[model samples]
Target: MEPAQLTAAVVSIVNTLRIILEYMQNRPKRRQHEDDFDEDVDTDVPESTGCGNWEIVVAVGLVDTVERQFWARQTSTDWWDRIVLQVWDDAQWLQNFRMLRPLSWNTVSYFPLPKMRADLTVEKRVAIALWKLATPDCYRSVRNQFGVGKSTVGAAVIQVASAIIGVLLLRVVTLGNVQVIVDGFAAMGFLNCGGVIDGTHIPILAPDHLPNQYVNHKGYFSMVLQALVDHKGRFTNINVGWLGKVHDTCIFRNSGPFEQLQEGTYFPDQKITIVDVDMPIVILGDPAYPWLLWLMKPYTGSLDSSKEQFNYRLSKCRMVVECAFGCLKAHWRCLLTRSDLSTTNIPIVISACCVLRNICESKGKMFMAGWEVEANRWHLILSTQTPG
Candidate 1:
C-alpha cells in the first residue's frame, strides 16, 4: 500500500475502536437468561453497562488497582494517623486544634453526629471543624489534610458549628454569673461593673442581594458582632448578624441585652455609694454607645481632669472586651479573613466560635501566645492591602 493509504487506514481503524468502546461503556445491559434477571443471582457481567463478562472483570480489576494506587499516594504519610492519633499530650493537642483533646471529645460527645461513613467519626468531625475554624484554610485545603472530599469538609464545618451553637452557646455565654463577673471587674478598679460592651466587624464575601449594604466604613463587606465580655475576657452576651453599615448604637439599642438592662432585669439590684450618689451595677461601653443609667460611656469633647480620670478608668475596664475580641479572632481565624460560607450562615459560625472561646477561657485552656503574633501579622497584611 502507498504510505498515505496506510496512514488513512490506521486512523479509520482507531476511530472505529474508540466509538465501539464508548458505546459499550454507555449502552444498557441485557440479561442472557431468566436467571440473570433474578435480583439475588450473582452475575459476571457488569450491571450498569453492556460490557461482556470478561471485559467487566478486567475493568473491575483495573479500577481496584487504580483506587488502591490513588489512596496509597494520598495516605503514604497518613497525617491523621501519624500526627493526630499519636498526640495524646494535652499541650500538643491544644497546639494542633486550639482545644484540649478531652474538651474537644467532651464537647462533641453531647451531640454526636450521625455516622456518615466508616471513617467520619464524631471526634473526627469535630476535629475537622475546629481545624477549619482555627486556621484560614480553604475547603480544598482542609479536604486534602483530612482525606475527604471538599463537599464533606464544608458540610462537616457547618454541621459542627451548628452543633456548637445549639448545644453550648447558652450554657457558655450568659449573664447567669453576674455577681461573680461584677466582683472580678471591681477587683480591676471598676466598681459595680458587670461587663464591657463593644462591636467588631467580621469580613465576609459580598452577597448577591444588596451587596452594598454589607459595606463598612473601611469599604469592605462585613457583618457586625456586638459582644459583652466579662472581666475574664469571656463573652457574657453577643448580638451578631447585623449589617456592617449599621451603627454600633443601633445594634446595642436593638439587642436583647439592651431590653434586659432597660427593664432592670439584666443585672442584680446591688449598688454602691460613690460621693453620696448610689451607683447601680452597670456595663461599660465606648463613646459610640448611648449613656444610659445602666450603660456608662466616656465623656466626649473637652475633658477636665476628673472626666479624664473617669474615662481612663472606664477604658481600663473596657480593655477586657477589646482583648476578648482580639482573642476570638485570633483563636478562630475564619473571623479575620473573608469566610467562604454564605452571608446568612457566617453569623452562626461566628457565634459558635464565641461559644468555643468562652469554653476555652472558662476551662483555663490558655490561648497560645504564638496565635496572637501570627494573627497580628495577618491583620497587618490584610489592613495594608487595597480593599476589594
Candidate 2:
C-alpha cells in the first residue's frame, strides 16, 4: 500500500501537535465580551509564540471564564444553595440552617447602615465562616475560594461564631437538660452521673504578645478547650480560651460552670440519694479535676478491690468526653492542627466548633465515623479517694 494510503493507521507526536494547532487556529477565539463575567479578562500571551501559542491563549481564557463563573456562583446571594449545600450534605446542611438567618443578622446588626455592605449577603457571610470551621483550609484560602476579601472572611468568622455560641449555648448546654444527661450516664452504668469533664489542648501558632505564656508544659504553643461533655458525645459546657500553660484543674476552678456548682446554683434544689448518702448531681471528671461533692475523680495509682471496681466504672463513663472530643474534631478537622487565628480570636473559633457540633447533633446529623482517635492527654490524680 502507498504510504499516504496507509497514513490512516497512525499519527505521531508531531502530527498530533500539528492537528492541535490547526484546531486552535480554526476554533474561534472566545469573544472577549461574550459574557458580562468576562468584561476585563485580558489574557496576555507571552512573547515568542510557538505552534502551541493559540492553544495556551484559548486554554487561559477558558480557565478564566470558568473560574469567574465558579466564583460568581459561590459568592452569589444564594450561597446557602450554591456553597453551603455543596460543602455540607443537603440533609445535614438544611437541618442545621434554621438558625443561619437569625444568627447571620448579628454580623451587621451592630453596624450602621453606612458601614454595612450589601454586596455580601448574610447567607454568604455565614457560609464563609462555617467553611472555615468545617475544613482544615486557611481562612485566606477560604476567602479566595469564595471570592471574598480575606479580612471580610476573618471578621465574618468571629461575628458568626460568637452569635452561634450565644444562641446555642443555653439550648444545648444548660443544666435544664441535666435529666437527660443523667439518664445517658445511667444507661452506661455510671450511677447519678451528671456530666463528663475533660480538657483537650487546641494547638495554636505562637501569639504576638505572649508566646511564652501560650507554651504548655509539653513544650508546644496551644490553648486548652476544656469541655464538659455529656453522654452521647455532646459538649454540655465548654470553657475555652485558657492558655495551655495553665493546668486543667485551675482552669476548671475559674470557669462559670464551676462557680455555679460551688455556689449551689448548678442544679435546682434537689437531691439523688446514692449509697444512702443524699447528694446533688455531680460531674464525672478525670484526675485533672479536684474531687469534690460536685465532682467525681478516679482513684490514683493504688486501687483496692472495691476502689478498683469504682475506678473502672468511672473510666468507662468518663470515656464519653474523649469520644465527644473525637466526634467534634472529626466533624471539624480544623481543630486537629494549629490554626492561624490570633490568640484573642482562637476561643471564638473553638466556641464556634462546639456550637456547630451541637447543632449537628441536635438536628440528628449522622456521625457513622463515630469517635476520633484518643490523644491520651490525661493528668491522673495520684491521691486516693476515701470511700463514701
Candidate 3:
C-alpha cells in the first residue's frame, strides 16, 4: 500500500471514532431521582479564584440579588397561616412558642447560595418545624414550598424540636409549679384531683429498621403519647417514647408521675380528709391505669349507685385530658398523619408539640382573634400558692 493511502485510512477511522464518542456524551440521560440536578459537581472552588469571564460575574451578582429579594419577602403571617399557630404579624405567640423572645430575623438570617431563591431565618426555621407538625405536608412539599432541600426541611424540624424540648418542655410540663392544675381540678368537682392522665396514638410509617417494633394491636404503626392534662387543657406531665405495641398500663407504670407516686413523694403532705379518711392527693386516670393511693381510676366491671356517681364525676373531669389531646391533634394535624420521622425522633417531635400546645393554652385562645400589640410582652405566670 502507498504511504498516502495508509495516512488517509488512519485519519478517517480516528474521525469516525471521535464523532461516535461526542454523540454518546451528548445523549439525554433518564431522570432517575428527585434531586438529580443536584449531582455533585466538581465545584472545588479555588480559594483565590476570581470569575474568569465577565458573563460569569454578572450571572453570580444577579443570582445573589434575586436570592436576597426572595428571602426578604419572608412574612410572619405566612408562618402563622401554614403552621396554624393562630398568630399574626410579630405576634406574641410566635415569640413565646419558638423561644426566640429577643432574637429577630435580622439577627438570624442565613447567607444563602447565589442561585437559591429563599433561605430561612432562625424564627422561620422554628416556625417551619411547627408547621411540619401542624400540616400533613412531607419533606418534599416543604422543600418545594420553602425553596429549600428536603434534607434541609428534616434538619430544620429536628433542630427546632430539640430546642423546644430543651428550653420549654420542663418549664411547661413540671411538678414543681402545677398547683394551679390541682386547684383547677378541684373546681371541676373532682376532689383531691391534681391532674388527669390519658393516652393517645400518633400515627407513623412502619420503620424500615425494625418494622415489628412499630406494629400495634390495632394493626398499624404508631407510638403512644401519654399525657397528664390540667383542667384548662394544659399538659402538666407527658411521656411519649414508648412503641405503639406497648399497652397503656405499661406506659403509665413507667411514667415519671407513677414513679413519683410509688416513692410517695408526689404532693406529699397534701391529703384530703373525707369521711374521717385521710385520702392522699391523687391524679385522675381511666381504668387503663392501675388504682393506687395517688392515682385514682374509675371502678371497673360493676358499681353501686354511690360508686357509679363517683365514677361519673371522675370520668367527667378526666375528659379534660382527652380534650387536651384532641386540641393538640386538631392543631397539629401531622400527628394524625403517618409521620416520616424515625422511631427515635418521633418522641422528640411529640414533645415539641406538647410544649407548643402548652404555650398556646397559656395565652388563651380567646386572644387569638384580637391580638393586641401591647400584649406582645407576655411573660410566664408563676405562682407559689399551693392548694389548701
Candidate 4:
C-alpha cells in the first residue's frame, strides 16, 4: 500500500465520524420536544426513525392551530362583567331583566337559589330566568348574554323557576283581598261577582308520553291553564298542567277552587237576591262551565230578550279574564311560543310565569305597549291557524 492512498482513506473516515457525532448531539432536542407533546398526542412514534419524529412534530403543530381557532371563536368581551355591571341606569336594567333591580332583590330575598357555582349568584340566577321568560332566546344565546355556559344557563332557569313556584305561587295567586275584588266586579255591573274564570292554552312541543292527550281541538299540542282573574287583571286562582284535550268544565271540576266552592268555604257568606233567588258570591264563567250555585255561566242557545241581556252582562264582566290571559302571555313571551323544555319542567315554568305576572301587576310595573301589539298579532295568527 502507498502512503498517499492510506492518508486519503484515513481523512474520509474522520469526516464520516464527525457527521455522526453532530447528528447524535441534535437528537436530544428533538426528543425533548416530543416529550412536551406526549400527553396531548395519542399517536405512538418510534424513536429509531427520523420520519416518526417528524410526524409527531407535525401533529403537535396541528393541535396548537386547532386550539387557537377554538379560542378565537369565543366572544372576547364578557357581557355580564363588562357591559351589565357597567350600566347603572334603571331603565336599562328593566329593559334587559324585565323588572327593576329592587324588585329582583326583593324576589331573591324570598328564597335562595341552589349554589351551582361561585360566580352564579342569586341575583344573576334570577336575572337569567327572568330574561329567558321574557324572551324567546335559546340557551346558547342566553349563555352568551349572561357570560355562562349553556348547561349552566339551563340549570339556572330550572332552579329559579322552581324557586318562584315554591315561594311565590300561593302568595300571589290566592283569594286575598276578597272584598276589593268583589267591589271591582260590581263596578262593571256584575253584582256579587267575586271574579271571572277562564282557560287558555299554553303551546308546547309534543311529548313522548301520551302525545295525543295533549292535542287540543285546535290541532296543536298544549297544556291548559285554567285561571280566575279579578277585575284588576290579577290572577286569583290558577290550575295549570291539565291536558289540552280536557274540557274547561272538567278542569274546573277537578280544581282546588272547585273543591272550595263545593264545600261552601270559598266566600264570606255574602249573598244577593235576584228574581227571588238568593245567590252567593259567584265567579262568572263562559258557557263551557257548568252552572253551579256558587258559579255562574252565561245563557246558551234559544235565548229570550231577558236571557240575552243576562248573558251580555255576564260576558261583559267576563272580559276581565280574557284581558288577564292576554297580559300574562304578552309579558312572558315564553308562553307564547312552543316551549322546548321537558314536560315535567314546563308546568313549573308556566306556574312561575303566572306568579311573576301577578307580582308585576300588583306592583304596578309598566307593561310596554309594543308587547301588547306583538301579543295580539301572535294571538290572531294562532286563532286563524287553529280555529275551534
Candidate 5:
C-alpha cells in the first residue's frame, strides 16, 4: 500500500475509536441510584474535559454554586419538615397547649446531619412515655414503637416532667383551716413518718469496712428517704440526703424544718405573713411528729363524731401526697427495687421523677381544688388587713 494511504487509514481508525470511547463514557448508567444526564455532547464544546476552552472557569464556578445551592435547599427543607412543620407547627395540639417557652433550637443546631422526619412530636413522645409509666412496659418495646432510643425516651420523660413541675404546678398560696395527714412506711420495719417515710435497704456490693452510718436500726445496709407532701398530694417539699441509718424524726429535724423553727419561721414562703401576724405558721402531722403548734395532728380526743368527721376529711385530702408517691413508684419500678445509686444522686433522681409525674398529671383533665377559691378568699382577707 502507498505510504499516504496507510497514514489516512490509521487516522480514520483512531478517530472512530475516539468517538466510540466518548459515547461509552458519557452514556447513561442505571438511573436508579443517581441522576444521569443525556449522552449527547454539544459539538461546540472542546473534547478533553467536555468543556469549551473559553468556558472552563465559568463552568467550574457554576458547578460549585449549583452544588452549594442544592445542599442549602436540602438542609432548609429538612429543618422545615422535622423541627418546624412536624413538631412545633402541629396546629391542633398547639392550640390547646402552646409551648410556654420558646424551644432552644440552637441547642440542636449543632446536629449537622438531619434527623429523619417522623409523625411524632415532642408532646406525643412525652405522652407515650407517660402512658408507659402508667402502664409498665419494657424499654425495648417503648423504643421500638416510638422510633426513639430508650435513653431518648427516658430523657424526654425527665425533661417534660421538669417543665411541668417548674412552670405548670402553682405553688401553695394560702392555708385554709388547713389540716395535715402524715404516715410512715417501713421497708423492713423501721419507724418513719414525716409524710411517706421509709427506710429502704439499698443492698450495695458489700464494701470493705463500710461506715457504721450505712447500717440502719434494722441491722441492714439501707438508706432513708423522708419527704413532706402538701395538702393537695403534691410533694411541696422534699428532705433527702440522709444516710440509711438515720431515723425519720432525726432526718426531719436535721432537714431545713428544725432550723426554720429555731429562727421562728414557718411555711415554705417564710417571708409571707400568716393571718395578719409575722408569727410562725403551723404544719399538720400525726402524733409521731414533734410537738409544734403550727404542726397539728389529729386531735387524740376520743374518736367522736366531730373528730372522726374532721379526721376523715383531713385523711381524704392528705392522701393526695400518698397517692402521688404511690403513682410514682408504681410507674418507675426501678425505684421500688434497691437502687445502687449513690446518696446524693438518689434524691435528684427522685425529684426528677416527681416533677415528671406532675407533668404526666397535667396532661390529663385536672380540676382546681375547692381550696383554690378559698385561697382567693384569703387573698382578699389578707389584702384588707394591709393598711391602705
Candidate 6:
C-alpha cells in the first residue's frame, strides 16, 4: 500500500483537516436581513399533515426555534430578573465532565422552552423539584418560584429521583481495611461492633404483597436496615431490603456480606474463621441482639456511675453511625420522609447517597483534618470513650 493508504489506516487526520477547511470556506454565513420572512409563526397545524421524516425535521426545527428564542431574550432582562440570573450564573456545583460546550438555551430542546427569557437546565429543574418535595411549599409556590408548570413538578421530581438513584447511585464503595472493634462487657453482654444490626420501623404506604412478609412491629409497612461502620465511623457495608418483620440475625445471614467475609476475599485484610464459619458477625447493638460474637453490655440495671460511664463511652463510639446517617438525611432530605420507593429502588437511593457522601468527605479530608486535630484534643478530654 502507498504511504497515503497507511496514513489513512492510522487516522483520517489529513482528510478530516481538508474537509474542515472546505467546510469553513463553504459553510453558510449569517447575513443580517432587514426582515426574514414573518417574524412570528403560525401555531395551528394538523398533526397528520406531514410524513414521519418531514415531522422529524419540523420537530427538530421547532426545538431549535424555542432554544433560540429563549436565549435571545436573556440579554435584556430587567433589574429583578438580572439579580436572579446573576446569582444562578455565579453558583457552582460538582460537574467533572466539564469538556462539553455551554448549552445555548435557544438551541437546546427543553420540554417546555421558556416563553419568557429565563430557562433552567435539567439538573436545576430536578434540584428545584426535589427541594419542593422536601419543603412545605405547595406546587403553585414552586411553580411561581421556578417558573415551571405546576402540573409537571411531581412527575419531574419522581423522574429525576428515579434517574439519579437508578442510573447514578447504585454503585457501592469498595470495602477496605475491614476493621473490627470487639468488646464484651458484663451483665447483659451485647455486640457493639459492626452495627446495631436492627430493623428500624420505617412505615411506608402499603403495597400489594404476596403475604405478610414485609409487615413489621409497627404493623404498617417497613424494611430492614443493617448498617456496618468501621472504627473511623465510615460505613463499610450496609444492607437494606428485608421486610421489617425479618429478624436482624436473619437479615445478617442473608446479607451476603458475611458470605464474602467467610470467603476471606470480601475486603482487604478480612479473614475467614475456620470454626463456626456460619456464625453471625459481631456488630454493635443493645442486649437485644443475642447472636453477635463479641458483645458489650453495661453493668447491672443498678444506677452505678461506672456502668453509666461505660454505656456513655459505648454510645460515643456508636454515635458515628448515627452521625453518618444524619448527614445523609440532612443533605438528601428525600430520605427523611416516607418515600413512594419500591424495594427495587430503595437500595439504589441509599447507595447513591453513600457514594455522594464518600466523594465529598474524601475530597474534604485534608481540610477537615486541620480543624479536627484541635477538636480531637478536646474530644479526648471530654469523651468517656478511649480514642480508637
Each prediction's RMSD over C-alphas, in Å, is 7.9, 12.4, 12.9, 11.3, 19.7, 22.0
Task: Supply candidate 3's per-residue lDDT for 289.
Answer: 80
Candidate 6 lDDT over 117-212, as tens digits, reads 245466455445445434335555555555455545545555544554444343434344334433321112323244333334333446567437
Q: Looking at model 2, report the run of 10 residues with the lowest lDDT sum.
A: 379-388
In model 4, pairs of residues that clash are none
**lDDT agreement with native, every candidate:** 0.81, 0.68, 0.65, 0.79, 0.44, 0.46
Model 4 lDDT tens row, 246-326:
999999899987888888788888888988999889999988888889888888889899888888889899888898998
**Model 1 compared with the native: what TM-score?**
0.80
Ranking by lDDT: 1, 4, 2, 3, 6, 5
Of the candidates shown, which would achieve the greatest TM-score relative to the real structure? 1
Model 3, 4-29: lDDT tens per residue? 99999999878766655554455455
- Give residue 73's error in model 5 in angstroms: 37
The better-scoring model by lDDT among 1 and 5 is: 1
Estimate, for each residue in 1-388, the C-alpha lDDT of model 5 and write its tens digit.
8999999999987876675556556655523312332111112322344434433433334334232111111112243346444675434222222222122121111222223237545545454444343333455555554555555555555554444445433432112222232222212121122232222333222223454776655454545555555444455555545665676677777776567655654434333354585523445455556655444456666788977865665454445555555555543443444444445444554554555444445454322234234333433443333111
Q: In model 4, which regions exceed 4 Å deviation?
A: 1-77, 380-388
What global local distance difference test value does model 2 have? 0.68
Each model's TM-score?
Answer: 0.80, 0.67, 0.67, 0.79, 0.41, 0.48
What TM-score number comes out for model 6?
Answer: 0.48
What TM-score quantifies how close candidate 4 is to the native fold? Answer: 0.79
Report how far residue 306 has shifted in candidate 4, in Å: 2.4
Off by over 4 Å in 1: 1-77
Give the per-residue lDDT digits (tens) of candidate 1, residues 75-173: 222777677878458787787688888888887656856557676777777888998998899887787888766667777888888888888888888
Stretches of candidate 3 exceeding 4 Å from the true structure: 1-119, 176-178, 366-388
Better of 3 and 6 by lDDT: 3
